[model samples]
Target chain A: MRGRARDGDEQRFLDITGEIGPELLRYFQRRIGSDAPDLVAEVMVTVWRKRALLPLEHEHARMWCFGIARNLLRNYSRGEQRRSELSRALRATVSVTDVELDSEEAVAIRDLIYQLGPDLAEVVTLTHWEGFSLAEIARLQGVPAATVRGRYRRARLALLAALSTDVAPTLL
Target chain B: MTQDKDHPAGTDRELGALLARGARPTTEATTEVRDQLAEMAAAIVSTNQARSRRRAGLISVIVAPILVLGVAGTAYAVTNIDWSQLWHNTPEWAEWAQDPDATVHYALPGGGTCELRLGEVVYSPDPNRPADVAADPRAEQAARDFLRTADLLTVADVDAMITAMRDKDENWAQADDGTAVPFGYGTDNYNADVEYNMAVKQAIQVAVTDHVESMGIPSTGLGFQSQEQCTGADQ
Candidate 1:
């Protein structure tokens, strides 16, 4: 019975890995560009380590994986200087055209999302990009729903201001 | 683009849609990266399984003996067993010998004694004592390097080396300085003897140096001396 349960857990882990593996790869690619492959390996290893504790529901498990990825990114960054260094490094290596942004407007929006700072940027990413609700993000982040809501609100305001300024020059 | 207090929802919905579209995944996972992730997952599962088996075995060993004993005997056994010793009683080689009173005095090559306690060189009667007798800053670092090398050797490799060294037919020669060196054993097959001898010697050197340094002793000129040799020298 114990062996069977363990086998079931392994299967569940593999199932989730297959489902989200490509999404996770792209997630890291968007953030770290060429370093994504290595980061994906790291994130998968962590997911395997926490397999026993992962939620049975697929949706919750996906969020749990993202939570681990977020922690890994924070650890990798270590400081604001390192974070900026990573951004600069990625920018140097990857062209805007290579990023597959649909249009110039899309590139501008993506750039503005990054300007919201790491904390607000993550909140916006989880909400819009990942399609996690504020409550789901709160649970993943171990914070209150209200905190995520406030962060998302602030991030949206920043994005709106940046967008308006970007268009104002053309209008003038 | 116009901001309205009552219709803040419109602005949020528009921005959210834009972000969602922009951040959508545009690339696929390469076959190589996927395969590497699969390999890592398998390795993690294997490791966890081994850990779980070890934990189960340990728990059974502890629990089975208590069950065999009567209730009163079990209680007595639990109370009598020194739980502290389980963690504190590490092998002398592995332990950081920090007890101040448990000092080991070594005879210098020239004359007089070098007193080592914990990691400190408390006293050295030798006139040629280094300026820093308290500790060799490099000793711990050297020991760490040795440990990293030692980690590569498996238990079977270490056991094979020991067995070969102990064999009478194995050419265990004594150098002019009286250090025992093993040779010719397991040499024809695998060069196991040479590898083992080097590894063991390095381990012993690191252990002795690390122990002395723990007591704040200058590990310069200090060599690996067994407790028996030091005791016999004292006599």
Candidate 2:
């Protein structure tokens, strides 16, 4: 597997890099914006060379890569420069998972949603919205299947309750 | 309550549909990003391949000089170099033979080697050490020292020193005393050969060390080969 990655062939580079590149760029776009195009480009280069390190399936690898990207972008956004850009090309591409809210009242339920802690937010993003299976989301977030269920239930209930109360009306 | 062929709970029916709708990717967006990805992927492959080719080409070109010098070195041994014939017939031949930087080709019994070298020693007249080798003990000593230090890079100690010289994070091209020390001494053919060898040795050592380290292991006992070899200027 590692040998193929080192082979410097054009087809192999594209086969792995071609599909995930867009999902990753959008992943970055929703998280940061603007200068993210360049950062995403840099990460893709790293991914091309390191793709052999990935698991067999594309979607799993895509989620795994986004996990790594989240870490890197967080590091990049910390200080050196304020990453601010609504550049047309990047703004044109948004991760609907990040932008779409359930209901207007659902949006204001951040207090309740976050009440389960950041872990709840992660589970929702990975499982409910990102469409990853319960097992995949639990594995990704490094939590057990049961805990993932408990949090998913609590989060949904919080959202529903917030909605009933006419909360911020945005938290899905 | 909820029920469907896919979901046992009806409550999740709305959630699943909404999540699917929310993250729906536009085909047009994926297409545009795919084109950009292909271009960048091609650029990376081109850059890496170009670098590998350049390195191989340089080593081949630089090694070509050794072939020429190896032949000339053998010819000088068997055939007499008549000064008169050399002066009139092949004037350029005299200059080349006399030039310290001439390409010297050597023929061993079965195998051959070559090297391109700088012109002969243009001596400075230090009154105490005249241009004539018989008069200049310092010049003679300098030549001797140059030969002594130019041992096989196979020497464990010498290889270690060369590694140290290269390991220094210095711009060897500059005069900075940062890490790599330049081997500077004289203008004799032997000195010229040794100095060039030192530089080549440093680069080779550095390359080997770097390549090895990149593989997550420390390197040991990997000796570098010199680009130059001795020819029969003695006889």
Candidate 3:
């Protein structure tokens, strides 16, 4: 939002986690709604541990990640539900947006963003599609504050051009 | 699409920032998750290393007696140790092989070699005599023990045994009853090879128990395979 912030050295996380994190977040969110944060934490821990399993290609990695998440979903369901308050306490630890994006739009945005090369695509998609704060993306991507901005600028312009419509300044 | 994350009032900027956030688990979470997975991987490696070390240790233990005896510098001193009594007291292969008739040899791949011939072959000759015996694990094992037994023999004796092993005859002769047999398995120059092969068999015999166990044989089943699937390749 602050005009394309640069997140430097996200190569490792970018190369691994990519956009899979949020998709996993959403997956855990829906399968076990309000308990989403704990599930998200659990899913991420899984991603990190099995990070080697992720494909080097970010797109393919995301798909493979979700496939794992789907399995985790089964695991979560079969599990005896933890105390509601305990999960509530865990969810409260993080300030995540409750706003749900339309899956169809999320997919469209993801596809548009994916069109960019890895770096620009990652920043653009994570910021716009996955809904991470620049601070968070900067942290995860391991980039200094400025690089994220440059990537975002190039990403926004490219995204705008790809969408081909200035009518809704943001979707691009 | 409906809410328009990109807004003229700088909505797309805010939208982009939100999209990039992924869940970063805490350190405890990271450790907890990776611990189990890494532990599983480590366990597999450790198990293999342990088995290898165990076999190595067994071999060292088996060879200890031989080295002790060799260093004692007197064959008679070795013969004097009521080996049967020692074997009964120790209740281990080392004592059992101390018998004058029992042959002991060190082999590679671990499980120090011990060939306890019950004075004679327990099972009848494979009918075809030694050739029909087909050099199974047992035969290979016996070959090793024979090496040690042959150790008690003079150079001339080893030469004779090596000829028999090769199925040829340098000093080939008929028994008093004129039983002219082809003997080429034992020769003096072949001692090194015999030593090496015996070491290999010792290792194979010890390390291959796992493979042999799964082969549906009790693994202790008498008689060696022509080519043991475990440590041996097609000979």
Give the higher-DockQ candidate: 1 or 2. 1
lDDT of 2 by residue, B1-235 (tens): 1123112123475544433333323223456566766665665556446545644554333212111111111112112322121112221433434433223233322232234233332223324422221222233222222222321121112333333344452221212233322223321211233333344334333332332222222222222122344333221
lDDT of 3 by residue, A9-56 (tens): 123334344334445545455334555544544344344333434455
Model 1's chain B TM-score?
A: 0.20
Which stretches of model 1 miss by more than 4 angstroms?
A1-4, A78-111, A166-172, B1-13, B17-26, B29-235
| Candidate 3 residue lDDT tens string, B111-141 | 3333322222222223333221221334333
Q: What does DockQ come to for candidate 2?
A: 0.08
- DockQ list for all candidates: 0.13, 0.08, 0.04
- Cα deviation at A93, candidate 1, in Å, is 17
Which is the leading candidate under lDDT? 1
Best by DockQ: 1
Give candidate 3's TM-score: 0.24
Fnat of every candidate, listed in order: 0.20, 0.16, 0.05
Which interface RMSD values do the candidates have, in the order shown? 12.8, 14.2, 20.1
TM-score chain B for all models: 0.20, 0.21, 0.20
TM-score of each: 0.44, 0.42, 0.24
Comparing candidate 2 with candidate 3, which one achieves the higher TM-score?
2
